[model samples]
Target: MPMSFYAQSTVQGTVTDAGTGQPIPGVNIIVQGTSNGSTTDFDGNYSITNVNNGDTLVFSYVGFVPQEIPFTGQGRINIVLQEDAAELEQVVVIGYGTTRKKDLTGSVALITAEDFNTGNNVTPENLVNGRVAGVTINTQGGPAGNSEIRIRGGASLNASNDPLIVVDGLPLNDPRDLSNGSRSILSTINPNDIESFSVLKDASAAAIYGNRGANGVIIITTKRGKKKLQVSLDSNTTVETLTDKVDVFSANEFRSFVQANFPDRVDLLGNANTDWQDEIYQDAFSANHNLSVSGSLLGDILPARVSIGRSDLEGLRKTSKFERTTSSVSLNPRLFNNHLKIDVNANLNFEKNRFAPGVEGAAIVFDPTQPVLDPASPYEGYFEYLNGSGFALNNVPRNPVAQLLQTRQIANVRRYFGNVKFDYQLHFFPDLRAVLNLGVDNSTTKRFEERSTQSATGFNASQGDF
Candidate 1:
């Protein structure tokens, strides 16, 4: 055996983002086989003393890939780290505890932030749309509208197909009905705030959640503060248009066919022309913005993160829209020689929505020759076929656009979800650990729906606030 002695020297370096080239503060740098270590500051600079040429330097950060570089008498070494997709997905968060995927068995699926769908994924369910193998995301209408998420399909017809949603150890309700304009309970959560998703598909994998896991279990872990202080902004705008307009006759096309086929019946048609499908649909725009700040608090003793996000989603239907504001805070701290870990996370969400019921089917069958509006006609200036008793005719269809606009359903919802967990490893047995978790989920829903007296669906008017 040959033994060699290497002189110890101080090493200094900067850590930067691989893609953005931005300075990354709070990265941990440690020399292998030694306690000698240091953390980068706000400028992404770190100086570690007593590093030998034979020693290996390890650089690690949350979200970014870890790196190990062997010291070869270099005084300074700058490093760039790419975002690590496996940082969140490779480690599993479940009822028992965090376990690596390679060590876990049963029908389990993982999806990290990197695996999320691109474009305007405003809702939580939309993030996993086509990514998971057995999970099916069924969206109704358009963005911000109701959605159905089924894990390996439904187990029973009587119960809901929604999987049990556990966010940071807090269980929450999912979309169930049309009461809320945006029926989804998870609508308040910002998709950008999500770190990863673990789906327990099989009975054995979901057994930890008990009966609630019968449908399946979806574990959602939100992002926590990184080792370094970091600021990030995510903004995106999406435009949606009717790709192929029903493939039906337009106002002009219907008029020509009506005249060529039945000249005598043309007398019953009105002079004004309208395309029902075109009138009901519109070029929609959706916008999402998220800003987050994360770093160490109290001299690195506590890692804290704060995030704010807003989403404005416009449905293809002219009358439907959803707006939401979301804010969250997370703190994780280690104590007692890294044996005790405490985690606290909280989220607040507010939403305002105008739900659009299914009226697209009616748009196709409605007459294209009729006008959308008439001054003399009732129903809020929308043309309505009335019977002798001054009621909207049962046989004749109402304007699809009017059906959406005249009957208004507005919902304002607010939700707060929070959780705190404490885990302590036994000093006697390093592998043994004791854990305690507490969580709360609270929500308030307010709705106002009205059908004007003159509208086709309205024989009486109904309204409320608060």
Candidate 2:
């Protein structure tokens, strides 16, 4: 073999960012095929010894691409690294701004439409029930009713514990003022139209909204137009029935108890046996449908999505019902070769509701021995107590069946929510951008209550409208 001698020399170099030209500290610099490695200091300078001039040098760092350079007898070498787009992926929205998940230190969870729960869901919260950690969703209790969504639970005892709700950059109100019953906070939005939900569970992530976000923040992003023409329809029907009845005294059980405990009180029991709860509760059916048309328009420059939805929800309690109609128009278009992006969205919703009164108490306590109907009684033939003048008493509880059958409470609500967002990306600097957002939320509600002359609860016919 021919005699060969290789001299090991030290290589010193400075590493900086290619885009900002700023020094990057803590960068890993290692000689290829060897265990010798060194890290850049605060000034982005590093030195590696015991390395031949022909050996390759590898520079690696987080959020930046790695570089491999060969030393060709050069005493000093300088290298610039470009950002790795894959390592810096955009995370879900946080306070209307976005960043990489690795850079975020706050507790945040994102639920996309694909991860949502399936069924005839009545509210938007129902879609995310039990899907995300540190988030709890209490679904609607009745037809199109309200639900309580808590992020990391309540933080305060005196103030509101409800999280601030933002839909398409517009914050939604409590919705208690939107209808007579103030049904659902997210009832205006069709569940099928939602694209994703970003939940901020910690104080740091929700700090952008100030005190209103003390409980947390729920950001709802609806679907946008797609490039190709697409038509979507989501329809489902749900039937609701009482899972189980309360373990209350039955007709026979009540009579036997009363007779055994107090013989004198036995006179209060009647011959007929009635189950008040059975008479008040019934099976209910709800139907919902959403139709959407989305595609690119204006020579593929403007993409738009238009949707219409309708829901008819019947309460498990007899004579209670809710009906809603909603329409939405969304446009997301990029102009000037993708420099300017515009997001325009408008949503309109109309609702009609018939509220059921709190009569379950009377249903459970009402005498099970009395017959529901009396032919000779003056109170619409519904049995009731009579005084000396044969009039229904004012202080006594009314028949549960009679109350639900004779009373009518209705509300008509209309709401319009719209928002426009403009984002401009600098041509010179792709990472820098400016954003402007404008929004409006308008609502109107008309409610009325009417009761027949049932000679109970109220003796005369009464009506109130608001």
Candidate 3:
């Protein structure tokens, strides 16, 4: 029998502080040159399986020096990590420049990638939740939810209150641009591609941007390729059940109660109690898929990344559905031996929205005074078009099912939009960098609608584009 691979490896270790000989908690112990790793417990004991005799074990702590010790078939290895003071002096990137944690005069907070990555439906401010002070994040109801952000007590009385969003160096078109009382741009951005986000609140930090800086700025940095060959994949699928259903009365229940009250004129009340709204609504499901790839270009001349994503969404009502597809590609290439750098980025989006028709204004003619679907009369419906040269029944209307079936209405909209931008970076002087940028945006919207002829109620078909 062949020997199992798992039978040949075992690594165990204890982690303690070098300064005081006290047990260190949450020290990450990993086998060198491998993804296999484990953390120390509260008592500082850790065991990593599947490590061979020749493999090296590395001990790492956030504020301590990382130690690598060669393993020599030992059952137990003890390690102590010395605290690193320089790590505390490290500068963090703020709005304009880097600042040490203790030296910062203004308030600035940092949020790690691990904390914000948990939410699948993360909003712009969701990334900063609980990590910052004096910032409020508001999320409205529904799948196409709206998120409102306010920093340091909102400004402007009768004007817009939404925070400004800047991606890379470009100020994004108004967040309200896509908010036609429904959708917005924040929901469209794929969170997986985001590398980091910084919120600029105070004037000292935002004044450099000018004008729109009154509302503050949210700087978004997208992922870029590294020098080494690297490939990564992230996939998220969300299953959300229907929160509530449309209110409707059953077909039989609608008819029975009407007759029970007015037995003598039961037929007349039947048309008034018809369940039209119930017929047009149903439960729906939604889903989203995203794929992204990044890598170096030609081993150092350039680095690029491409990402594609799609969202298949449906409303609780059967008649409504929305689909959006987006693709983006970015390239940062060096010229003249890294002295000059150029960045080119482009994005394309395609969207489709559709909805079904419902009852029209003329359907109100359904009267309780007269019975619909008259049995004695040759014409089943109470109302009819061109009944003997402009003559017809007076009060009641036709069967709603037939009226709805004969009259079909569809609303369909499709849009295509994209942008291409180029930025040139010059590094000619020390402590100073300059940029020249030019970009063009192009977009087109098209709409098509169809309405079937309603011969019974004297409604006609119409079609047009907008």
TM-score on alpha carbons, each prediction:
0.76, 0.78, 0.57
lDDT of each: 0.83, 0.85, 0.60
Candidate 3 lDDT (Cα, 0 to 1): 0.60
Using lDDT as the measure, name the better of candidate 1 and candidate 2: 2
Flag clash pairs in model 1: 25-228, 26-228
Q: Highest lDDT, which number?
A: 2
Top candidate by TM-score: 2
Candidate 1 structure quality by residue, lDDT tens digits, 416-458 = 8899999999999999999999998887889988876667666
How many backbone clashes does every candidate have?
Answer: 2, 0, 0
Instruction: Give lDDT tens digits, candidate 2, residues 1-466.
Output: 4222357778888999999999999999999998999999999999988777678999999779999999777778899999998645746888857777657888888888878998888778889999988888776567867877788887778777889999988888774443444577787678888998989999899998998888899999899999999999988898989988777888899989998899999987888889898899989999999999999999789999999999999998999998989999999999999999999999999988888887899889888888889897887899986666677765677888889988999988888998999989999998999999999988788889998765476673222111
Compute the lDDT of residue 281 as modeled in candidate 2: 90
- For model 3, residues 1-466, the per-residue Cα lDDT tens digits are 5455644567666899988999898999888889988999998998888877677888998768899888777888888889876755655445554466556565554454655736555344556666656677776544455577787777889898676776655566653653232245565465666776667777766776777877776777667766666666555556554454345445465456667776775654434444343433345566667787777888788888888877766654444566667677878887776666677766666655554334433334333233334444333343342243334433444544445444433323233223333323355554555556565444444555443333444442122111
Off by over 4 Å in 1: 1-89, 180-182, 252-264, 388-391, 460-466
How well does candidate 3 match the true structure in TM-score terms?
0.57
CA RMSD (A), model 1: 14.6
Error of 3 at 275 (Å): 8.8
